[model samples]
Target: MNNTIKILLAEDEPSLGQIVKESLETRNFEVFHVENGEEAYKIYKEEQPAILVLDVMMPKKDGFTLAKEIREENSTIPIIFLTAKSQTKDVLEGFSHGGNDYLKKPFSMEELIVRIHSLLNRVEKIKDVEKIKIGNYTFNYKKQTLELDNISNLLTHREAELLYNLWQQKNEVLDRTFILKKLWGNDDFFNARSMDVFISKLRKKLKKDENIQIVNIRGFGYKLMC
Candidate 1:
């Protein structure tokens, strides 16, 4: 999977796009470069790349719109947004639109390469784990799916990671700071809020089984009592 990783890159600027494509190719990544969001979406539907690098200000569909659409189809694929806007609102909006990471414009190619490698490494780790059993559900780490009876619920990347951690430490109080740092790479306020959102989502998904409960430990973290 190292040399076979496929990346879909969408950038409006011709020179920048070419440079990025070349740089990634030199790193042994298979890249499909497109000039606009419309082409990006079309290629994405056809190829289903492992990761996405989208420029925010595209001609047709726009990066945020493309990311939302792609996310609806595939929740686990990592999305990295490129934009010149550095406002907090814009960054949060990118995350809300299903972006896993954000890169400001005029960024170094080396930085992009490092970010891609880090995300890919994290994904590889998730895929290495075997299926986990929680209450009445079977959690497939690789697929990021929770199956019960004949119904299956697919989880977002963050949801799967958070649930995986809790499942690993079931019946024990897992620290909030530890989870935040492990999952988001930070314990900042915004990331903490994001962690809360994923926790709520996991609880709702696990509610199908009355025997399973994710209890929050006040001033601590959470305990998954199965």
Candidate 2:
């Protein structure tokens, strides 16, 4: 699995790009490097790399735009932004665009490797839990479906993610801020409202189980009670 892990790298700097590709290769990560966002997008569609490392400033499409496009197609893939911008706003923007991690320019190759490993490990853990029972609903994370009384409903990627988080913290309050960051990458007003809509949808789906309840804690968060 180590050698099979693929990374899509988009950076315009020849020297840095070569170095990064070689460094990741040494770590047993298969990397495909592109000099522009257009090429990156093309390769990503063709290869469907396990992870993405993007530079903020690039020719054709920028990293943020590339990431957004990718997220529209795949919501779960890990994305890391490589950029010189270190401002808080820039970091927030990276997250808003679906970046899983951010690393500033002139970063240590070792640190980049570590961040990649960490993100991969986190994803592995999530995948390891094949299915979970929540109240009367059985959620198969692998299939991204929920079953109640032998009736199964296919879930969208975001719906499955939100449901998984709630199930993990069942019978406990999950902070809205934490949930927004975990699922949407940010906790801004727009994302917050978006989360509310998802929560509502989830409630309606789980309504078949009378014993299950998702209660909103005003000014705080939500609790999944069974």
Candidate 3:
């Protein structure tokens, strides 16, 4: 919260976008509002905001496509999908595509503020550790990686960082925001969903060890048990 939190908001609705921009600005967030997916991507590269809010239905590529492209370049930025589509499939698709959170359209600005703050709070809890040994996985914190039996998974930059953060906390619950911030730099819906994808992937990768489990804490976060 001490840092000036920058946001890249991509929405095709001019009035709604403007209102959101103004509301966020009033609460001290620096928001750059754009109308289309292409502009969102361009401004994203230029501004490198701390978080991104994207409308699912937009011109010049949808939010889903934009999120994918952004993930290709930077896998760690927090992303939230704003959409009227409430289908379970759409929500799952958003998560599968690396979204941290998803908000249905006509949401309250106060709720949005709380979500943003919560996400940022989690991101701030991750600190560097010296090393962590999870079953056969040997993680070197400085390198931000996990290696098993001399083989390396060659994780995404943020992926490795998240692993280190989880290891630092060990059996404790790593709040969703903490992992989101450590990996995606925000805890927005898009980023939260994306973290779930990564967590599943990591769990599968480490299935060789029955001694370790990434237990879902049901509504809160995850615990990396040793």
Which candidate gets the maximum lDDT versus the true structure? 1
The CA lDDT at 1 in model 1 is 31
lDDT by residue (tens digit), candidate 2, 64-148: 9999898777867888999999766676677667777778888999988988887777677775566688877889875668998
lDDT of 1 by residue, 164-204 (tens): 88988999998999987765656888777767767887889
The TM-score values for the models, in the order shown, are: 0.75, 0.62, 0.69
> What lDDT is reached at residue 19 by model 2?
96
Clashes of each: 0, 0, 14
Better of 1 and 3 by lDDT: 1
Backbone clashes (count) for model 1:
0
Best candidate, TM-score: 1
Question: If the candidates were sorted by their lDDT against the true structure, best first, what order would they fall in?
Answer: 1, 2, 3
Off by over 4 Å in 2: 128-167, 170-226
Order of the predicted models by TM-score, top scorer first: 1, 3, 2
